[model samples]
Target: VEHKVLAGPFARAFPDAEFYATDRQYSFPLNLPDSFLGLPPWTRPLPESGAASDGSWGGEFDHEVLTVKPGPGSMYQDAAFFHGPSGTLLICDALFAATEEPPPILTEEPEYLRALLFHARDTPQEIVEDTPEARRRGWRRIVLLFNFFFPTSAAVADLGVGPLLNLRPYELGWGGWMPFRWKSREAEEEAFNKYSAGGSPTMLPIIQIILSRGGSGEDTLRWVEKVKRWSFKRIVPAHLDAPLAMGPEEFAETFAFIKKGRNEVRFCDQDVAFLRAAEEGPLSFSVYKSSLGVLRGQPCGP
Candidate 1:
């Protein structure tokens, strides 16, 4: 396999990160000999033991083994890679199933990897493929992860599904696979509506937004408006120190005010409630962009 160098732009954006080490013989933490800005513990390998069930021995084999743990501190920390204010690109070993693990790291070798990037509005097909720039840079197997947030309008595009499209086929080899499971949108909406009616702290809609497979820009704006309205009516008055509320239309006006870059909006009780809900899981509000050029969900603990 060709040893591809990390992209210069990526390096510049994340000065402290390092390239993946191919050697498995080396030990954890120590194995990452290259200098890196201190990363989280999950990035390092930890000693663990798992039982082997072959049924032939009739006994479980218990042994301490070295394993890699994925965490926010390592590759995930560089929010620029996942979600940027505009767009971003990120590279990682594997995108594991939500239930299997935290941030899944590839350990075995078929050299599996995931490349994520985002675009502004429409996919720049020409720029991605048949372009001297990318070809000269030695980019192969570019697969497009359709933006779940904006499907009809892709945040990034121009890549094909399989290797035939100058991209590699997604394979389940990195210890696990992408769990095709997603939360039910209708269920989430109902829960959100119920919460709003009763002024109960809930995170269903936020989770739905995060896990949504596709929607238009208008849809996103609409959803944001809904969030704002729910916050205003249900969470704000009940939670905020100083009660303030706005309808969906009024919240849009407030959003416009914030977007004007005039003044920062102060956190209200509703905001705190939303944040707390996000922290509790079943919700994602990460604004960081990934290499695929889309905002990635916040890291939810396992």
Candidate 2:
């Protein structure tokens, strides 16, 4: 969410490349910016995927477009979906998978990192796991979601978090499957008051809510149906070490967190700061949790 806001750098970085997005949320000051390749808006009311455009990649790539228009109060208003050859679906910042791979970043001591991972210890058992053969047995063709599960170690490369660095104090809370206690109320309220009222949208809450609570169940169901209809099999996140072998059964487990009751999801600004802090930056995880405890409207220990 920080930095990379400028289209100037991107304009220089890929001068020869043609950029196509649903809409340019970030762009040059000029009314007619030439850096990007333009595409039409998805104003039509069609649920099914359709022929997007002639293969810009010269018949080597066939593109199908799917659109996600999140409900009110959502950070993501409009998202464009792309399906490439071999059933690969491309998306950004919308869905994420929580894989078993170790965090790219660590907390100095491996032991301490282990302690942090203790929180992910209780991941649900019901999400189905199948062998490659089993995954391929019944389905001849399957849709694969790229970056379906975000914040993956590989996806965030060259960004704020990526390439398997040490896990920061805050990133430890990535998977909401773990039960965490907030440190205190005053700390949390102070943060919300400071950041929310006077500033632009921060990455903390956007990442936190999706990882912990899945944002909205209604939206999840809608997307899940789309995935199912498309028969997506693998999840190829931008930051994963490699594409995860997935199917309907796999998507079921990967996205289950989003179905959680909204009442149960909680975000701690203190933790967000910690997670986003510079490497080895100081922040008390205990205190951060306490701060979240306060945000949840729960009593904290004195």
Best by lDDT: 2
Q: lDDT per residue, candidate 1, 8-110, as tens digits?
A: 3445566565422222222223334323332332232222222222222123222222222122222210000111222221212211011111112321222
lDDT tens per residue, model 2, 25-97? 3322223422332322321222233344544555543333333322222223223243445665444444343
RMSD of 1: 21.9
Per-model C-alpha lDDT, please? 0.25, 0.34
- TM-score for each of the candidates: 0.16, 0.38
* TM value for model 1: 0.16
